[model samples]
Target: MWYYTLNGQQAGPVSQAELAQMLNGSLPSDTLVWKEGMADWLPAQDVDAFRNIEATPPSQTNGSNPYAAPNSIVDENIKLSGTDEIPATPIPLDIGFCISKSWKTTIACFGAIFLTWFVYILITSIVGGVLSTIGTAIDGPVAVAPITEGMTQQAPFLPSHNQSINQQTGTGAIIAGILNNIFTMFLGLGLTLIGLNLLRGKDTNLGQLFGQSGTKLFRLIGASILYGLMVGLGLVFFIVPGIYLGMRFMFYQTVIVDKDLGVIDSLKYSSSLTRDNKWRLFFLFIINCFIVLAGALALIVGLIWALPVAWLTLLVAYLYLHDGERSLAA
Candidate 1:
């Protein structure tokens, strides 16, 4: 039993959520009439003009459908989306289910990035010092400068590098940089874990989310690599295609968490969810990701604000989509 006041007349017994959607144009078949509180939905006998508010609560009584719906032939008008006939809900930026509680998760994700950078810098600095000591022997100590490069012909016995680091250029340095990339890849794992926990609306602590624990933690590392690859691939087809791809694969984290799918399956499922709702999802994505666009337009300065806002909107979209799916299933 539900009650609501529409226009000036009071009504009772309407399923609130269902009726709200009907009133909001979701139920295409229902034509609403007007009464006092419900200027939108009134019976033919009670049609009136201006609605008046009643300070008093309406009778605490439930009512049945005065006129039963006819058992007439109904049209099977709903359009199908994909081969499996899955009906994923549209996730607009303005929709409900997003939370401010997600900021911690966002922080955690970014923290992984920062932590990786710091660690890589530290390791390279240490390794550079050792090589600099070895290089000093041949140069005869004339105010020795650090061998910023990992290894070169100058230190052929040590692994030779073909890349530049700090002030050193060699094969060894490039190998160190490669190792740093690997470190960052691990950090990306941390970000994926935090993101998944955030999607679940869980109390996410960055350290805890990616703690050295089990296979799930390592799987996050793989997902992060896949995510980066997908993002790059998404950009390969042109701008609009890239944007669409981003939105289509937005559910990868959720797919991994709730569905326990592999990286490829998560990407596949996320893509499939957008089958027929591409345009709708694209338009809504504009709203949710407008901050990102704005930041891009602003160049560097806008990035500070844009990144966080875009992330929040992303969280919002994820929640809206998942909640809607749950509700529809229920």
Candidate 2:
């Protein structure tokens, strides 16, 4: 059985002869073709089996070649914005290919990725612990008054020492939570940047965790805020819309980091990129959930491996959807 890429979607399980018949010398030689046991997709021209196939001459195809490449104009200098060449109609996602590829990458770079995650966790934990301690100290322990048989229950409208303490504690907790989230977001952006570099086979090190800065950092934060508010609002109104928007804007971070798109532009691009592929994305999410759960089951330490694999799998999906198999590392 063989499979081929047609307009950025995987198409087949067709027999070799059937694929040949379908190609009929109509598709471009650069179209990617693959079959089980092959390591990765290769241009049809590079495969031995397709060399003998000849293009159907323009004169023979009744004035129009059905397989002619789209007329979309692509900027040759831009490395990542291949969207111009992609069809606006929905594209198919290969979930199995994503997971398998992500697993292989995880194995290949386990040491660096694991160490990066460990440092992130360590910093987050220490800061969180310090914040909790400060909050506790600020909201001293509540004193309980002994109840007398005749003592009336405290009036609902009356303010008491306990209530004041509770209010102060709540305020402190909220502040702590906000600070923690911002810090984590900063670290996460850097971590994701590292993942992208790793995906491209670029060298990565610990310092990359703090690689983001200036206008790009601000844009990422702005996009994140908008994304969170929109998703939260959807979740508040109804659970379904939240899930829908969540999947729609899933690639915002990647777009911001990889393409240097502005906040609103990143959101728009993510929506465009994810259009018509939500179901497959959802399935991939579920599969990653299982992978994480399995890792959790293998002693809590398994998270060291599970978490990165899950994250890398999503990144793999992003690359696949953004540029098809071409952007993926073999």
Name the candidate that leads on TM-score: 2
**Alpha-carbon lDDT of model 2:** 0.73
Candidate 1 achieves a global lDDT of 0.46
Candidate 1: segments with Cα more than 4 A from true spot: 1-175, 185-201, 212-240, 277-306, 325-330
Candidate 2: which pairs clash?
A: none
Give per-residue CA lDDT, model 1, range 175-246, as digits (tens). Answer: 555555554444444455555454555555647433533454455457667776767877886766667777
True-vs-predicted CA distance for residue 120, candidate 2, Å? 1.0
RMSD of 1: 14.0
On residues 247-285, what C-alpha lDDT tens digit does candidate 2 reach at each position? 989888888777778888788778877778887898899
**Clashes per prediction?**
19, 0
RMSD of each: 14.0, 9.7
Please report the TM-score between candidate 1 and the true structure.
Answer: 0.42
TM-score of each: 0.42, 0.67
Whole-model lDDT values for every prediction: 0.46, 0.73
